[model samples]
Target: MTTKINRHLTWQRMCACMATCAMAIVVACPIAGFASVQTASADDTANTVSTIIVRDGMLSRYTQLGGAQGILRQPLENEHPTANGGAEQRFQGGTLFWNPSLRGSYLVRDGMLSRYTQLGGPAGRLGLPCADELAVPGGASQVFQGGTLFWNPSLRGAYLVRDGMLSKYAAARYEQGPYGLPVSDEYAWNGGARQDFQYGSMFWNVSDWWKYSSQGPYPNLAGVSNLNVAVSIASQRVYIRDGERVLYTMITSTGINDWTPRGTYRINGRGPSFYNRNEAMGARNWVRFIGNFLFHSVPIDSSGNYIVSEAWKLGQPASHGCIRLTVADSQWFYNAIPDGTLVSIW
Candidate 1:
């Protein structure tokens, strides 16, 4: 009886020892067996996990954003080091960028991503994306460390604005301001840079920046029976009309004290340029609506130099007897209006 009891006690001790040894093995390498389990359970969002873990890196963000079920989809490649001690990784849905200076990762995908890559990716002018893509008034945009990427249907793809041009755009209210979304990326022009927007193009040089309204070419107003020009002396504006339908409006400067005749007339002869030595001023692209009265550009000197002081008087009564327009608008008028077009001054 005593021998049998001692053998039973020894068997119990061996079982307890085996159980402790198994526990020690598991504690020593806690993550060793987790990959397979996570892979099998990845379909479930709550249970989805990243097999690879890196502090403040792509893998950690992937798991946090819902792993396989997240918008990032599945990991296509392992996390890799980037320039400046940063890290990045590619996934099925998009690429993840992890900046050491920033807390987490940013995702850039679809058209925005393609444009970013074209602009030089992380090594390019745009650098790494600082934030995810965001919806704007007309289209979508994503912020990068160096600049912002813009995408819309009208743009055909994505474009970016950076540096001084970007500052000018922001001041102008971005896409919501006078200029709409960027239609073209910044490009070298002369010794400076230029970027085109929906309504205008912004130019930047070493010292200053300026904008030009891109009215483009005049539309074909053919076969319209009631095409006419209405000049408003009170509002300092010229309204182009097809019957009562207002097709376009242009800013103009007329004579002070109503020197411009307020009577019905017809557009007659046209000339490229004229200089009045008596007035010591000149103008270009004149379309004569009446004798000694015409539609012409803002006053220039006899040497064909723009009179800055006179040009500044646009949108008010500043001309002597002719209707003064911007050089661009006057040129457009000279090209678009033909002989026998009706003109009414009021």
Candidate 2:
């Protein structure tokens, strides 16, 4: 009986050892290999075993196991108020879809989201009912419309706003005086105010003694005659038969060479008797016209005659192309001649 009992005890010990060896082999194998075996297990009891064990974070575990590849793990509930409110779902190939309560589902390609319906709501406001762009008026100032600011088809100037009033600068306001009429003191003082005057009526402000033509009523001299008798270089003598008779006749030196031009000229300027020491002589009331050329009196010698000294004469056409006359003759010419009187030369 004792022997039989010992045999039963040894058999029990052997069975226990065999069970421990099987447990050790299972623990020694790699966890990945063991997991694969568990997943591939065909037995209904082994199939219930999960390969991935859930640990601390349940949400993280759910994402790793339950989420589809290339898709959003959770629904997007956070967005700006201006943005369309919805839960955004992501799919493979980076596609996004919006699911809203009021609006139907929409597909988002790239970064833009477009509605699927053409209903009379926010979608209609996009293009059909709303303008492509909006414009705001600048300020309380003037608003320019279809035409130009100062919409005159022909006229041009600034359209200004001053003291809350609209005004224009134009060429029809402060007009110029008529021909032969004196310019007003106001217009002459304030030249800027005359910019809007009549175009042809304006005349330049010349010296006090200067006068413009009246017979021709033009700036240029044409068939006009002198108010008094005048001499020409070509004739070398006063031509008084055409108008007033000569009071006296005197010998005068005319311009030499072609330096003196022949034309109908006006006595534009005059001055009192002055000495030109460079020519070593005294002149009276030297009349200047057509550049530096002048009509003046030259010094005479002791014989009571005009001196034609070599220094006074440049031989290459002397008198600097001016008419040299006696002092008495020059004084008479100056007092008798008017500013705009025509002086003819052949």
Best by TM-score: 1
What are the Cα lDDT values of the candidates?
Answer: 0.73, 0.34
Q: Against the true structure, what is every candidate's RMSD?
A: 12.8, 36.5
lDDT digits (tens) for residues 148-266 of candidate 2: 12111123221211111112211212111111111121133122222111111222232210111111121222333535436555434433222554333333456666566667677
lDDT of 1 by residue, 1-346 (tens): 1121111222223222221231121111112223222222324332232243233356567667785568876455567877656678887688899876776698889999888888778888878778889999999889888998889776579989889999988987788765668888888875798887664566787222211213334456887679899898876777678987756666678998889999999999999999999999989889999998999988889789888788767667988879988777788889888888889898
Q: Which candidate comes out best when scored by lDDT?
A: 1
TM-score of each: 0.59, 0.28
List where candidate 1 sits over 4 angstroms from the true fold.
Answer: 1-60, 206-283, 286-299, 308-329, 337-346
